[model samples]
Target: MPTIVVDVMPKAELLDPQGKAVAGALSRTGHAAISSVRIGKRFELTVDGPVDDELRASVQQIADEILSNSVIEDVVNIDFGDAEPAADASTEA
Candidate 1:
């Protein structure tokens, strides 16, 4: 199985209220050195199949369709699994 990890964030063009809230709270708590903080989401998924181009596209589609809001959000990263399988299991080249 291949695992896909996604880091989603609000689009740079849009205003992020949650991020502003965090920044405000930080400044109030004496963290004035920090100017801003952008809030985002991370999602990890286990996909069953080889980590090929098709699988990568599918994972991207899933992220765009369900994991992120295209109107105001953007996907930052997608990482494939790195675990090595046991010798008994078949692997893709």
Candidate 2:
């Protein structure tokens, strides 16, 4: 099986309330030296066939159109996760 990993995050201009709360909690709990935290989402898709160009493109489209919201979020990354050889990857957003 092949797996594609998608990572989505809120746009830089927007505030992430959950991340902020976690950061505050960490600071309060004495996990010092942390300045900020921004949380994001990750989606893993396991596929049935070998990874190919068409499959990759479809995944990219899905990531951009379905997995993330263009208004508030960006599809930050797509990892091919052992389905293909590692290379320098392009960020989708």
* lDDT of model 1, residue 12: 93
Model 1 whole-model lDDT (C-alpha atoms): 0.76
Each candidate structure's TM-score, on Cα atoms with residue i matched to residue i, is 0.76, 0.87
Which segments of candidate 2 are over 4 A away from where they belong? 83-93
Summing lDDT over every window of 10 consecutive residues in candidate 2, give the lowest-scoring window. Answer: 84-93
RMSD of each: 8.2, 2.2
Residue by residue across 1-93, what tens digits does model 2's lDDT show?
A: 877888889999999999999999999999999989999999999998988889888888898889988899987778987655435444544
lDDT of 2 at 63: 84
Q: What are the Cα lDDT values of the candidates?
A: 0.76, 0.84
Question: Clash totals for all models, in order?
Answer: 0, 0
Q: What is the Cα-based lDDT of residue 44 in candidate 2? A: 96
In candidate 2 the C-alpha lDDT for residue 22 amounts to 95
In candidate 2, how many Å is residue 12 off? 1.1
